[model samples]
Target: MSDWSPLHDAAIHGRLLTLRNLINQGWPVNIITADHVSPLHEACLRGHLSCANVLLSHGAQVNGMTIDWRTPLYNACINGSQECVNLLLQYGATLHPESDLASPIHEAAKRGHVKCIESLAAYGADIDYYISHLGTPLYVACKNQQLDCAKKLLQLGASVDQGKGLDSPLHVVARLFSGELVHLLMDFGANAYAKNAEGKRPVELVPLGSPLFESFLEREGPPSLMQLCRLRIRKCFGIRQHHKICGLLIPEDLKHFILHL
Candidate 1:
């Protein structure tokens, strides 16, 4: 799916020795194809750690941009390589994208690469970074049915209700009628009654015979006390502070209760 040159071919195929030989022969580590794709992007995109290491050592542009504005870090995240993500960050790879569609964090979340998402967040990437087309990372995770990515984004304090325009994360997950996703979104403060562009609530999206349909009908009338309490507790702690529940001097069971474990 990537346009490549001879150097790109070597690095992308994990040919560490061949890559080193090419660079030794005065081939530019930063050589770009007509499309501005670098060997580093190719190496990281294929998750060839050693080849990437060689290229970086030879002064490859860590933040090199492709014609579409994709950087090596974004390519690394697309490859789902947490190590490569860390490596580029160490080399000062920018977490922000020149193009919204090229965002490393959104790409990671959309592809269900939870560790890659975590790495990006740990390096100060905006967890709730919203794009004009992709919404937030949480919404992308939800729309793709990537439950783990959605849960991790929530834990890292991504806004659950802030999705593409009127479409909340809840709105996307409800269309799938996935009970697990619905429960996770609810736990993370997604609005059950949130409306989409079509003015349809999440519950309205489910088919009648779907297991989630009657379950929603049963619970939609009144908020459960436990659910209300959970919300209140999270509100008190705010977003990221919720992750600190593990470090609190509370009973283990109480900590689990707070974490919805």
Candidate 2:
């Protein structure tokens, strides 16, 4: 944040009047600190919607990236500012970050910022967008124990088994010993016996007496009849056709059940 001008301070602090005055004096709205932190970046990072509006209206780079590759939209999602997110999107902010480390969708999922995740998905973000280090957004959500995000991703049709390489979301959840997450992923059709690069199953990663271990042990063989039925119905609909299931003439309860709502 070195070499930051008063504009940066005004934006980060939500100082609308001072921000306007600096702009009136012809201060560059797009000026950056040595770290490539722009006033617009500051405004959105702090959820200062008014300051963000002024900067964007005066030609701030909507997609301006920091030295660490963080965008204004990425910053907004990190802060869980749905208002700022909408404002940035209105000005044509790119939903996908160039760097997977700072992807807006995955970042939101990690923090359990369900509204931000919903907005990103509604705007056509790749729900299964994969990063080499972080795996898919669903894996990130599971790794962070963000149950709401994991469910939301599933509702949006994220592939349940697509984790980092062969390490599925179930692996991350089981490693954390979270039985709730384990059941959630299994219900969504995660592979229980999935082997990571080291050939470790999720069950082997947890303590023997742990609830997660018990759950994993009980999951041997094919899923129960009800689970099989659910999986079959979803398979017929497929991932792409999931959204259209709501329009099907099925019973309301059946639709909700199938959608995992």
Candidate 3:
């Protein structure tokens, strides 16, 4: 119950002079409201760049997390406010690791905010940060048909096949019949041959009568039995190959199976 809480609220509502006066009076710059959201979150959400700048200059914690774990940067990216995003970055907001909910990069890419994505990337946000529902930022971009955002993420080192779900970004794009995204993902080294947990390759996920289905049939060619076997083993274990391989391994090509036994 500091005298600054109301001033912080006013900052969130974009009352510039009031916010400046409070900052000048040495008000606590990083105070979170009752909900644990810092004034910075609200200012950025509402695109109040001036108020945000005042808070940042007054020593606000740029990356303060809310009760729900969202940061001011996350809100700015979600709203696709490039100026706010840049200002937050300039003020030293750190991108939190990807969790169950989407990261700021995912939100920016999903919204097709190229500048926001770039700003986040330049600020060291993980371009490939994977999240639930949206998968990687690139995957979300592709799913939303945000080609430019997908391209930017790829350029920033995002993998086209970095998720744990049944579909790679390419698979999702193919399922959505987005030829551009499919091509982009393939060019970025998406393993079209990669299978999801269901034993279905990206090609197999395409609907039977769709143009993507035809394209996949033509481009998929064939996967070797070794590849298929590895895919099956990965699916059986419910683990990604990139994770450490545990237990036993057989030697024979066809008999080379992992044993949890």
Q: Which parts of model 2 have CA positions greater than 4 angstroms off?
A: 236-243
In model 1, the worst 10-residue window by lDDT is 215-224
The global C-alpha lDDT for each of the candidates, from Candidate 1 onward, is: 0.85, 0.89, 0.72
TM-score of each: 0.92, 0.93, 0.73
RMSD in angstroms between candidate 1 and the native structure over all alpha carbons: 2.4
Best by lDDT: 2
Q: Write candidate 3's Cα lDDT for 156-182 as tens digits.
A: 556658864767787777767888788
Ranking by lDDT: 2, 1, 3
Q: Which residue ranges in model 1 land beyond 4 Å of their true spot?
A: 1-4, 221-225
Indicate the TM-score of model 2.
0.93
Q: Which regions of candidate 3 deviate over 4 angstroms? A: 1-5, 25-27, 97-102, 132-134, 221-261
Top TM-score hit: 2
Model 1 — TM-score against the truth?
0.92
- Roughly what TM-score does model 3 have, to 2 decimal places? 0.73
In model 3, pairs of residues that clash are none
What's the CA error at residue 11 for candidate 2, in Å?
0.5
Question: Which lDDT tens digits does candidate 1 get at residues 45-69?
Answer: 9999899888888898888788799
Candidate 1 at residue 240, lDDT? 65
